[model samples]
Target: MLKSTFLSVACCLFIGHHAFTQCIAGGSNAVAPYASNSSNKGVMFDITATNTVTISCFDANLPALSVGGYEVYFKTGTYVGFETNAASWTLLGSEGSLLSIGLNLATPISVPVNKTILAGQTYAFYITASNPILSTGVLTTTNSGYSAITSNSDLTVYGGAGITYPFGTVTANRAFNGTVHYILGDPLPVEFLDFTAVKVDQSVLLEWETESEHHSDYFEVERSLNGIDWNRLLTVKGAGESSVKEIYQKMDDNPLDGISYYRLNQYDFDGTKTSLKTISFNNKVEIGENDIRIFPNPIIDRFRVFGNQSELETLKVFNSVGEDISGSLTMTCHEGFTDVVFKDQVEGVFILKSKTNSQILIKK
Candidate 1:
């Protein structure tokens, strides 16, 4: 009787171990609107650890009788180009021998192990067919429940080819791409619900709220005068770990004379840090100068001049005393953003002249 009991327990342990090792693939149940059109598009996710990152499972939609592998890469910028070029890339991992595929089937193909990644830097990962001869599976796409931080990374894609036609950054409302499952980095500790900055008299007030916190240590408030040079202002305690909403606020008693930038950094108990988005505030400034949107209002040498491309022809800047400053105005337009760059400009208020309108632009 004793021997039989011991054998039964051993058999149960073996079965459990075998089941855990198998990879289960997943994808959208029905046809979705998004599809992986080409190799120049992928999802961008930040590596949460410094030691090593592992891609647990890879899922894809393949054609019938497909047999090939994928080459995974880590890139800095868009899906392709100098940033995605071989000179500036880190080969994370690769896998082969993915065989016996069916028509339009979404399944977990392979699991590659340890690839080194930085702790706090942003990275984009893409998968390409190992060989061009065989049919390959692309990351099937979808777009639901994509608002929060989930297993899905932000979907970024590129459309152009070669050195001349650059694949500009275009964020689409689609996810459910390759490798939906990850056993690599730790989960994001805090989910920010809302973050806003308001100017109250001489001081600026910074406020933010989080939906949940896990193993969170504290919040470090950083201030910047030019949005480039940052300085630590204060630290506020977090909820440690909670599922309820938590509200936090900090006052910048010594806001700069003009415009200032504020950003939040959340730290975990184990020294893991994540940066929240940045916001700007102006102490004594106009909300919208003459019904024109002049952001970072108290400009720090650089600001954008937004206007409908067809409606506006030329953008010029003049000093506070109505003198056109001696400098070059470079304007670049892409993806509906027109940035007016200024060179050799001094601090103070100015006027931005467009074809049909003029706005007061303050420089700090």
Candidate 2:
């Protein structure tokens, strides 16, 4: 249907349970009347954080950005380097006019980029509009000097503007005007509490629970023999908006042989769809849970037999500070179970991972 999700915040599926901070970057506005041009030249930034982060609200200053909003385009690498690089530009999506900071009007709302940025990656964006903003910076042929606006510890601002919509070539450095905001592992789609797919005879039963939902429309169930190619099984209606836990179920009557993956995707009312999560269910399945789980979530120091133990080779523990302290754990092997003892004085949230399964252990 050609649903344009390129630049809409609807593409953002927030699943983050912790860590949120906002930061602002400085910029220079037009001194004189800017000549009206229908192209986009936007702020550029680089991620320096060690971990991957989700950036939602990044405000780009579009001078004379009028009643009609702007359509934003994005590209990786530097603007000047993309001339013959053959890496085509991407349609980043759009922002509402009410969210834009212009017309010396009412306070503008924050617009979201909703992009998950990896460490050490650089990005640049250009805007296109029907009633283009009137600014001298809109149509600059030469390098207007570099606009280095580094703000938060996560994002460092860089500068580059292009010719017009579908812009490629760049002269030197362009003025970067905007704000950069990011969150450490912030995920917000339909807050999925848990998604599980079970084998029931020849058919597979898919059931999921959501903690909360916002602007949600419907759910699409897809099956993939391999994790790559997917086919839609059916569509289940959504709750639209809800605060309490919402339960949804879909059954796949014709189950595939061996192991097949079931993926759940949620679409907003506007048609922006995001994959919630994927689970692998084997036709020949075990009666118990797919993954061996951990229990007695809140544990103290010393001997804490919180969860069930299975023979695992890959076992690692990470503390709340994102430090790997897997070596500190002392494991006591018994006949049927293993008693996992923690080091004394170690507290806070810890992640215990074995193979594909991870259990969150909170020290109280």
Candidate 3:
């Protein structure tokens, strides 16, 4: 959810002939107290084992910045260098609803790296935001790596911070702070897309589609009041081994009153499971449902919300399509009012908002 300081040394790995869990480097993983003053950042490393590595989860360290969120991307190979943006890179999903700086290495950020790196291949990754995060208009991966530092026999971490997708010019080898958590196995056989949860009347409807799958057994639908604790609601049969798109759905007939978090996990025939992605849905508005509203019903650029300081702080907005687009919107707060703006502007779209105490606002 946040971050920590990291120690720069060599790559260390824990291995098993079949499957074992290990991290990217050997040193203690955390954030650096200072910034390298670089552009976008990521990690570059090489795995030597014949067995592939599955990137489970990873965390980043921003020495002195609190960000709205981070848009993360990953690519295979040992990082070619100098990137402008993530136009060409593959998406590993996003991390941190609001990635802030702190000291928490025990928890891996939720930028689900459900990707598998081929045997004896290299890999690269980076995290970025719409705006600079460091105090000096920079975002850091922290300083916790070195050039050709072999942490063990199975893996070799190359160089310090690997600069990625620079907005301005370029800066390389700034030491990638934080560590990448990997599993000693191949990627999941099945691939999925568009996992969504929507409030359908009094219950919640969960739906997801798969592009391809092989040796897959079934999918587990789990729900949580908070994102931490999860309970398995039901299991749906998988496509087994299909090449076309497969659709699946589940119903949470007893969802929480306000916000409910839903997570999707797929299990293989051999019982190997991979956690896909987590999304949230607002069941209903409990209070202030009629009084809550946004100005300029059909906003062109921006809108205003009149509320106290506390109400403004807890405000969250979703699109008509039901995605948690809160992090995509910007906020400017005054004493008794707050200005809201969506960066990716579009016309004729509606917005759904949820504020403190289940207050709801719907605007076209």
Candidate 4:
């Protein structure tokens, strides 16, 4: 047995035969009585079915004046005819011919079909009343199941062309360091969001949380040395819904000597893609003349400095804005290496300047 469904007709009004509005279910519009010219009005029906169905239009006015002079078409194809039930379709209200009728009346009509439908098939019904002069009236119509054993199906109605239905899902899992680190889901369209990054020991960690998603397909993590030409580092999926959260993370083990920029490329399921806001990082780890080393370079918590010499003197750390963070000379440059530790400082870019009289170390 097929599923039960209902289709209700809504009335709409047009004035002066100039402007047009949508004709929804359970709506009505008032128009002034006309004498000669008949105006054109219509309602479109979108149906998704698996078997043939019947469409009927009815109003308060019947027999005296019937709905005959109108055009009907299917959005996906063409309408064959009104079928055998067309004549039996009922109408109510007093009516008369165009030459004799002076009072305003309502008319209704119906069209039935017996064609077979397939699963997931979509079809549309359009009814239009066209006349050269002024013909102002109301049209009411309904669609009902004619075949007894029709397949159980559903029909999604749309207002106009190019409208898309929201039918997607997304899921995320895995959390680390008090934050979610993994995500996967359907592709969504384009939108806006925020991303953040942090430096942990020798590895730079990236994390981004999403509040909502739409037609978003996936995201590509990109990295750049000079904030210019970027290369993709990783790809993350999107959640195609609202009121959901998605988290993504990636680690860049090898940071540049100066600064690095990162961005995300959000792609849609339809091949449409856009880039997110770019973030820059000023890495103070540099290779010097005596040895390649990194000091408390703006080291908020703790950091270690390394060099290729066995002798050392003083280690000075300054913030990226040239503010002195710490100055220390307690270093035993053994095997050309030493680690300086600074505790409880703000996280930001900094410069480490080290000197051994005969050898000087500078990192920005």
Candidate 5:
């Protein structure tokens, strides 16, 4: 009876060991019949500022899959690198346990992954089997497993002036077999704070101030005939600072025939650039005829004119005491408007006259 009992105990131990090995082998080499060699089995995700995305599993049997240990990679043109393990992937929803056979059969598992991309940059995500034995059946063979996927997630990333990315993609195996995709976004607009044009006798002076700059590389002064097909007049460097005020100036002496439109081209420090608000003025100077009308007669600071002409050859103004006062006034012709500012003249009645025209003014 003692011999029989010992023999029974030994047989039981052998059976238990065999069962354990079978379970491990089955789970590890279970012939992922659905394993796909096609590159399409991968997925890509695009994220921008102020957005979020969720990744989930389709198989109900694959729970507690090893997602934490998987590696992530990114491709930006000729540059390629791996993402830092810090916060690279987040586990969302519920966490399940390992299957009895060492396989993960948790299905419908959800994981939310999010990240903000800078303007002109590209990004994506990837996953690999962490433990061959434990993750055997974690991935599926169906379209849900072998196919690539993407989500509508966006995060906001701030970029300096003129910074942009031309090409980017996400790779699964870091080879041509990985998925390829494109990213989309628009740069923030440029703000022009104070824009003014002063018309002096011989030229039109343009001046403007900026309250803030975004991706500002430089600025180009553009002129247009009918508000279309503009020609570049001048290029000004941009101040690449956010929320900081900047000042700029330009001059256009060669006036147009009709209404002239002027605009600012705000280029970022990078190659990218955008246009600012456009200002228009009419250049009406009669080369042979003069019909000039000066406004703001009680002139305290500046004055303007309404006329039908092409140019102003000369202008003269005298105080009641016959003292020359025109020296203080600076005149410019824009389209059909003339801008004049008095800086040195004193308060008194004055006589104003152009080459072919004359008028009386009272300054108080």
Candidate 6:
């Protein structure tokens, strides 16, 4: 991203536009540095992908601040485009002696490659400027000579020959022709330090660390029983912007039996999402006698286990009337209820067995 010190100005300008108020110069002028009160000028051209355009601007002795930079707004029509199409660049202040302050009437400004543009699209490029003292300077637009001015302040008509003053007067020989360019953004915003998943007793522990993050919003921890159908377990808030290493962890208390897969989905503040590599861990733990108890016999698709189950580990479901069914058991506890979900189990009576207790569960 091409960042500049004029970010605050751009933000304020965009916000003011939202309020339906136009920023005007001292009196009736649309804005200083800009010539026409109508906010349109003569001549426009199209710039293609990754191409470069040179714009001309001059800082003459004016009431505005003498130093600092300005903003550039580009769009396909006479109307300004979205805020994303706007960019700010640096401007050279008056540097020479007093007599030669306005000597450089046409300063060349180049559109950087980082600024993106659509291919095969025509755009009207213009400047929205403010000097160091927040006053508009007498800056002139640099020209590329792609079109001639048909009339002043009438960008809809062009190709005669002459320059038009901002106040809408046509001169015999002057034109404003600035080039527009296009380029793609080429940079990664996040760097991962480490990501790992481990089996912690009856639960799965997922931990990931990022070396640095930019515009990060949050991380979604996704769990999968078969690595095909994934479910979001939790979303951890991220540091909006960070340069230092950040560590995050998520505990999947209700992980599927045998093997459970986990991955991290990072979302940027701009809504861009990226997924980290998936990791699988065996979540099956050996069942042993403990102090937990399952209750409410003849259960439905689910059942609960309670009573001193805080220390209980392994849980499994079995067919009470036939051979051990080919189903996976997943468990999670909350509010004194250990939720047991059976995958691939048919409707019938089943055995819900934990480290400490067993109960007859009915699936209807």
Tens-digit per-residue lDDT, 1-364, candidate 3: 1111111111111110101111233222222223334534343333333446666565555434355445455556655452533333544444334445553222335555555666787776655543344323224434444455334444445544444323333455555445556666665677654465544445655667675898999999887887789999889999899987676867777877766677788899999987777776666533233234344333435665543233434555655466666666666543233556643555334445434333333232
RMSD in Å for candidate 6, one decimal? Answer: 26.2
Segments in model 4 whose C-alpha atoms lie over 4 Å from true places: 1-191, 285-364
Candidate 5: TM-score? 0.30
Top of the candidates by lDDT: 3
Model 4 TM-score relative to the real fold: 0.27
* lDDT by residue for model 4 (190-220), tens: 3233454455455665666554677777888
Give the residue spans of candidate 2 off by over 4 A.
1-51, 83-87, 95-100, 103-112, 130-147, 168-171, 186-364
**Global CA lDDT of candidate 3, please?**
0.51
Which runs of model 6 end up more than 4 angstroms from their true locations? 1-187, 285-364
In candidate 1, clashing pairs total 1
* Candidate 6 residue lDDT tens string, 1-364: 1122111110000000000101111111111133321212222222323222121222222222244333333444332222121211111111211121232233323211122223333334434333333333233343334343322221122222221221123322223332222113323346553345544445555666665688888988877777789898899998888887577867777767666667667898888886644555555433233444333223334444543333344455567565544234545545334555543466555655544466555554
Q: Candidate 2 lDDT, tens digit per residue, 59-178?
A: 444445444444444555555555322224433333334334453222222333445557776655554442345222233222346554454555555554444322334445444444
Candidate 5 residue spans exceeding 4 A from truth:
1-186, 285-364
Candidate 2 vs 5: which has more lDDT: 2
Clashing pairs in 1: 25-108
Worst 10 residues of 3 by lDDT: 11-20
Please provide, for model 1 over 1-364, each residue's C-alpha lDDT reduced to its tens digit, 9 standing for 90 to 100: 1111111110000000001112323321222223544322333332333322333345555545766665454455433334323324433334445563544455554533223234443445555555446533344344433232232232222221211111124334334333344433534677554345554444555666675798999999887888789999989999999987677868777877666677678899999987764555655554332223343344544554433443334455777677765245545543323445553466555777755567666554
What is the C-alpha local distance difference test score of candidate 4?
0.36
| TM-score of every candidate relative to the true structure | 0.33, 0.36, 0.55, 0.27, 0.30, 0.29
Report the C-alpha displacement of residue 280, candidate 5, in angstroms.
Answer: 1.7
- Per-residue lDDT tens digits of candidate 5, residues 1-364? 1111111110000000000000000100111122333322222232222322111122222323233222222223112232222123221112222232113322221211212245445444333322334422223222332122222234321110100111113323311111112223333435443344445454666766664676777888888887778898888877777676466767777867656777666677667755444666656533335655555454555565544343234556777678765555566544445566654566655777665777666454
The per-model lDDT (C-alpha) reads: 0.48, 0.49, 0.51, 0.36, 0.40, 0.40
